[model samples]
Target chain A: MSVLTQIKQAPAANPIERLLLATEADMAKVNALILSRADSHVEMVPELARYLIESGGKRLRPMLTVAAAQLFANGTGTAVNFAAAVEFMHNATLLHDDVVDESDMRRGKPAARMVWGNKASILVGDFLLGQAFMMMVETGNIGALGVLSSASAVMAEGEVFQLAKTGDLTTTAADYAEVIRAKTAVLFQAACEVGAMSGGADDAGRKALAQYGLELGNAFQLVDDVLDYGGQSGTLGKNVGDDLREGKMTLPVILALAEASSEDRETITAALGDAEATADQVAAVVAIMERHNTLARTMEQAQAHARSAKAALEALPGSEMRSLLSEVVEFSVVRAY
Target chain B: MSVLTQIKQAPAANPIERLLLATEADMAKVNALILSRADSHVEMVPELARYLIESGGKRLRPMLTVAAAQLFANGTGTAVNFAAAVEFMHNATLLHDDVVDESDMRRGKPAARMVWGNKASILVGDFLLGQAFMMMVETGNIGALGVLSSASAVMAEGEVFQLAKTGDLTTTAADYAEVIRAKTAVLFQAACEVGAMSGGADDAGRKALAQYGLELGNAFQLVDDVLDYGGQSGTLGKNVGDDLREGKMTLPVILALAEASSEDRETITAALGDAEATADQVAAVVAIMERHNTLARTMEQAQAHARSAKAALEALPGSEMRSLLSEVVEFSVVRAY
Candidate 1:
């Protein structure tokens, strides 16, 4: 075969792709459970739910869950339930978030709210959360349940904290760290920790995996914040600089605001959270961030978290799973696409 | 002392009042647990949560939990947690519902969403739900947790169903029954069932309390529907016919529409979802309902459920607590104020 044909026939080329390939059998189960649980007699529940679920993002969170479980134990049954529950929690957050942010786009399509309305989005989010908790309860894993339930509460608090901080130029780097940890990293931590629990990992292994997931989550969110300013529209699943228009206090903005000249700062603040902001207005702010090296600095911060995440996996013995997980973190920080 | 003074000093005079007085000590603990659990690091979470929690409706749901538990066991300790969790679930629903309904008032005051804006209300509701699950997880009662988590999901489905049926003139009495059972009765049933579980009741007792709660809840909602037309403005915590204006398919509306002539039906339909419907317009609908005996018939339906609720208590052994519970049911349907 020609080289192009050979490449096409190859198994998988990258960390996330390889992870998906490795977890295919297990993810099929998780996906089935997710779809079955999303079903309801109320037709709209399944209709709107499937619209979002089938839109099909990377399913990264569930993948981490399945991966962590496999890393420790060989295909434990509870992992399927936990993985499904994690995905549900993640999607539930996304549904509520679109309403809160009043965003028009999610996963590069009109948001479920746009189709169904904000009321459905909120109620459906509630429905998914109920499903998530029911899944956890069904597994009869109280330990894992506790970790996830606590994480869920923290995530809500994080969102509230982030919402409160929105459009406030006074938001600091420390506050930004808190926001990222609570809103994003906590769930990742819970996902891995629960997977470890289901896999019957020992205390040290569970702690290490939890740390790895937490750090990876931090890196993932940092990259996302940077992407909101730097990535393509379809790539970000939203317009460029959505964070600015939403008044999100992302690392790039915080860093730029701290470093820019008074005149340049004026430019940034004017566009920050201005929903009517022109493309030129956002481009101007991006230029300010680039001049201050804030975007790249934010990437560096992501890299640091990725390093810590990779370091966390060292607690486990060397294995293909460990290496793949490590590479996932590394790719998260480095990839622009 | 004057006779009136003695009457006031003796004790609570009504069945509901007696429930309040009897459950006072336990309700205090439930309230304390509720206040403490509602506390959070995010300022707005606690502030909004407190605004709702402290707005202090009768605290009826938690009272049912505490009462059920007390009837079966003196004090198992888990009941307090369950009671607080129940209250949280309730407040979370109210916050979300107000946002869904675009309600300006709740519990005779400005709705939390009106005070804090829809975003804060939604986030805080989520935060409270998380805390509720955390409380459940902490109790380690998987059975009660299952009951509640499932009820939470059902409640969401019921709300969605109600929202879908809003202003839908084709709504049937059966559909209304399903909506009430899912949205209102299920939580009440859960509260009592979990309370019974925490109190270490036998299956039969647990079931009896659950039935009683469900029936009582049905009666309670029916009464609420009537009160929207019959009760004073401040008493309803919303204006008269707010339900009509919102196009809620309450029993009276459904019953009247089924019997009304096309001309009268047109009048009701026009005012059904009209937020701008004036007092005179609402009164005209009420007059139509009275002409058809629909409001009184709704009260009869409520009375039937109340009888069923009282009958449920017969399965339990006779006791002061059991009689008190029965009286609460009877009072529910009979009360006009």
Candidate 2:
């Protein structure tokens, strides 16, 4: 049977095991390529890069690159290169975003900007972004370069959109989704879709994989917003109510604020919209979220996205890899970390 | 005659003319390709993007891309695309640099950061950089992509190197040159060489054009640094003494300090190194520069680079375009604005 036929058959019984074997298995090789493990500022940029990658965060994007390539051809090394490229782009965004937000912490550690000054952080981000394009060129895969460039453009647009909305309290769920998709899901989709392009997935297969990844990314972000609202509670590296404190209007808060009574809306807005919001005020906003059932509603929306993401994979030939991808949808909403 | 032969033999009074024509003629088409040129924040980003293209800052780098392509083969219209790509990259860096330096004016107007907040300035700079790569891919020129990507890596590395030396009084001319190459010259070299590549220039022609651009760029930035030390006397858009106030270690000061006696050196260091150097103190440091003839010395260096740049262009046969390129070497050291 063809490689495409092979990737499509038999969803795996154990999702995490497949995720580990398919994605994380090549970490050593990627580390060697980055030569970042031995860097002095490893704690600064390189560490942050690794933390974002290895902090048990899903490697779905890179896996998509791997799987996409596999659909057309098979090479352990080629797959690893594409995977690393996706991750490099992802980390670059995180670095810049932290500076843009004046964020002091990310994934529960002082952010790169906070630990290193903004200049170092910003320049390092640029360096990594440059390095990512270099890697794509090294691939000599024009198609892959196209995919990465498009994804990066979407990411930058998302960032600009987010900047446009900063401190504005009227952001809608649709607008929020637009931001998330531009900033987050576009890269995810591009990651998976590019895999197909690189791997030799036919148009139909590439389209399917891209759709699956985009939906999955949306689901992942939606749940991430939910968790920020006090859902799973004890995830290490998780900062509770950060979006609220930053006055960022995420999906849950937007929905909740719309549904809230005038008085509660006033209170929530008063607390969250202020950049100088106190912890007590932040806690009070969460209480209002509970009263308005915004958190529950957000979870419902998350589940719906998760279901759609899984459904995208259903038509693909069921392989252990596909099953693991399906399990990623569950993990998106289920895991605390 | 073939494109290479044509480039070699054509005699134009101004070397920059052909490049200027390529970019200037393409402006309408370039403007059309940009999204949301009339959006509310268009004044912020799209407007800046347009201002950048229209502002008539030396189109030297873009010209290099064009010249490089023409040297290699028939450029078709791909040279135009690569030209736009390099310009976008150059403009993005300029926007960000102004912000990082807290520079108040550029091209004779308030810098983008001064008009917009630092946050907006930075994000918009990022948007343009992303747009540049997008433009590159749209050109369907993978070689151009490789050239520009490597240039960006060098550009970023140069920025990091400069950041490392900021406020340090002991930086050498060699150290400064390394920074200038990374920060300013690589893109210039890439621009010319990429043009040659697009034009299907043979390897030797491509190499020659790259060297020409490198020397030309080095010449341009050296004069720029001299201008920072009152090289222009009065025609610059912004105040001349600002760099010293910001503790920026430019060439004039580097040379001046190197020759200062211990007492003068100590005074210069103490005055310039202060986070809040008084205007008088800044002026005092300028006086030290005058006493040491550092500015004149730096100007001599700039003139030497101009000669070198002109020499490099001689490798190409005499053409009107080549002559114009040579004129740019003179203009780099002599332009009033």
User: Among these predicted structures, which one has the highest TM-score?
Assistant: 1
Interface RMSD of 2: 2.8
DockQ of each: 0.80, 0.45
* TM-score of predicted structure 2: 0.89
| Model 1 pairs whose backbones collide | none
Tell me the chain A TM-score of model 2: 0.86
Question: How many residue pairs in model 2 have overlapping backbones?
Answer: 41
lDDT of 2 by residue, A1-337 (tens): 4333333443453454455555544545665665542133223445545554454545556766775565454434465666777887887787778777777776667776775677766666777778788778777777767777878866776777777776576787888988888888888888888777766667777788788888878877777787876765545354676777667778878977888888888878787746677778777878888887877777777788788888877767766567667777787777643
* The candidate that achieves the highest DockQ relative to the unseen native structure: 1
What fraction of the genuine interface contacts, i.e. the true contacts, does candidate 1 reproduce? 0.79
Interface RMSD of every predicted model, in angstroms: 0.6, 2.8
Off by over 4 Å in 2: A1-17, A36-60, A75-77, A234-238, B1-58, B67-73, B273-279
